[model samples]
Target: MRNMLPAAITAIMSLSVLAACGTAGNESGKPADSGNSSTAPAASSAAGAGGNASIKGKVTFLTNRTDMVDKEYKEYAKRFKEKYPNAEIEFEAVRDYDKTLKVRISSGDFPDIVLVPTIPNADLPKYFAPLDDLGLNDKIYFKDYKATGGKTYGIASGASTVGIVYNKKAFQAAGITAIPKTLDELYAAMDKLKAKGIVPLASNFKDKWPLQSWVYDLPPAIAGTANVANDRIKSDAPYTLDGAYAKSFGILKNLHQKGYLEPDINSTNWEQSKKDVASGKFAMYLLGNWVINQVIENGAKSEDIGFFPMPYDNSGKINSPLNPDWFYAVNKNSKNAETAKAFVKWMIEDSGFDKFAGFIPVLKDKQPELAQLTEFKSFNPTFIEGVPDNDQAIATQNKAQIDPPAMVQDFVLGDGKAVFDKFNKQWADAKKSLGY
Candidate 1:
């Protein structure tokens, strides 16, 4: 699912001056190194104004948080302007951010700053300005997520770990005294909730994207492999019956078969699901930690909502994947290149957007203060930071038309084995045709 953020706070009284950053290379697959540090470029004046005080100009920032554009985003712009009184930041919030941004990118008419979409790493320089001069490489996590040839193109805005966002009131009402630490315990808790006439979990099947967590995000933690996507590139039949894909999907399937999911799956609504969970009509949602704030905003008391890693198995050991949320990047063609770069830097460092959005800070030295995150840490789950998808792995999945979420929908609605067999065949054929 797409991400969302909340309103901004007061502007920082003191802001650091940043040097103008430059893009090192073009679309040709040449190294983007800026002839300074291997991971970042030396400060240069070619891109924009060199300091926050000197920064001036207007830049439009493209964002996915359409819900916050009118009020919250305006507050962000207001705070930003306090630091750079001469600079103006206009937000262009799109409901369908990835699709719209892709079209804008194809037409070479995107905004100055954007939440980097799902384009390949090799294509970064083709559209984005090098962010090396932001001097964030050494200080941030996932600095290399969008980097190639030692030059960073994007900086992660924040990080999240997928887990069960549950209502504590529902758990207490159902007499679930202990947090479920294993798959069996989770199912038992679901039974207790169901017996109390509550929807045990929200399938969110109709939304499609939320179902993706079961296949894309949960499997890595289930399999205890951080680089599972790249690891799949080595196998034509990555969807074996005994594989992590099967195990992860099976958990959701079991929920469906046992009637632990919401009734009338075809009519499930994402927005309503949040409200239902918040109101304790639904016990849980298997989603990222980011959803905690959304649930609270929908009326769940902050203390009533808690998060824990998904227990995909009964082993009691939990491995959660710590994944970055959308990355922030500067457009290569922005007329206000320096201003755009400065805005991106300011958003990352000074905006306080990460904490407000309930995400783990991308800055390595910073820690999230969310109570849910503190509770999650108490579980002592091994965190597996995500590995970037290999270009070839992505290519193979595209060629094979393997939509993990859709596969999950098929599993719950139709036959699980048949769905896997069909995809496995397509994957093998695609691999053979690609000579891999």
Candidate 2:
């Protein structure tokens, strides 16, 4: 594993010069070129201009999250209402989204607008509407979501970049300055903090997905490159496992053996994990930009925290992968497709919505009210910044496994563990209670 860091650099995604208007990376924490309209055509098309009339319809929103405190979908509905007065928004929140959606869609009680966290399945035509024919996919160059050029299903609603969120206060206490650039340095710092009795990685395996990220996150190693995310998805191919991923998991297993994770990762839930980390129980955690908003809501000072990309290698290159991570889809049987589409369009291009939403918009030219109080901008490092590698292959493997269907739902509710329990339960379908 001595050459692990250097040799792996040639395996990660190559750095692309990020422009505000360019669509290069997946949900990687790269800076985009900025400047565009303040509003969408339905609302803030040219800024400071109001449309004369509003269209009306009742659009049902099928969502994975049911938490009103989160306010992501509600912010969407509110902005949509402001833009279109005549439209009525009815939201149907699914507590156990996987089981619920399948049953409801089967029953034919479909919503007008639907939001999918990530659909690993490429056969979206059987489920969602083709945005290409609708003309939405025509003008936009999305990094993922293509079966055929003409059969584009949905456009991603909000994009959030994932990074290693570390507490500055925690770093200062250890008298260790600077974010770790290599795996060895990261572990060394973690050991230092551990000696001081501080947990290194605040983790909750009860949710399962967060930790599963260790398995799915590093495709550059498995795919042998980082840029081919979409190609792998479009191909009728089998999953492959090897390389950098092998090294990455070996690292995770060592962490588990070293007790760097929680006391019992199998039982640690996300709620307790988040509380512990925010209270400084852990030194660092791999978090998405969504955690920024969560921190604010939880009463943490923005300056007390900082974020950086996860660097698996020693050369200080940041992994900026462009993933269609959080996607919103329109129901194929929606009577309010036009209104639903209008709402989605407005959310992406609207500065007002972006300010509150705190996510990167998918539109080419957008006026994003991004927070500058954070150092995330200078923090965008390309793993290719120092190493050279064609990352397209890695990107392809990423898109394929990162959002696999069997992986997502099964782990979320312990369905995965149940199904994997015994050969006798092998044929048992991953089904939910009628109440869920």
Number of the predicted model whose lDDT against the real structure is largest: 1
lDDT of each: 0.75, 0.50
| TM-scores for every predicted model | 0.85, 0.68
What stretches of model 2 exceed 4 Å from their correct place? 1-54, 68-76, 95-108, 117-122, 132-151, 221-224, 227-242, 315-318, 351-357, 367-380, 383-436
Tens-place lDDT per residue, model 2, 84-137, is 777767677765464456566657677877764333344456666654433344
The clash count for each model shown is 1, 26
The digit string of per-residue lDDT tens for model 1 on 1-436 reads 2221111100100111001111111112121221221222226443234545557789999897765677667877887787778899999887546657877897998889998876667888999999887766777777777888789888888877888999999999999999999999999999999999999998799877788688768888887776676777798788878888888888888899899998988888987998999999999999887778778877888889888888888888998877788899999988888788877777767666665677766765454546786677668787666778686776677678676678888887888788888988998899888888
TM-score of candidate 2 relative to the true fold: 0.68
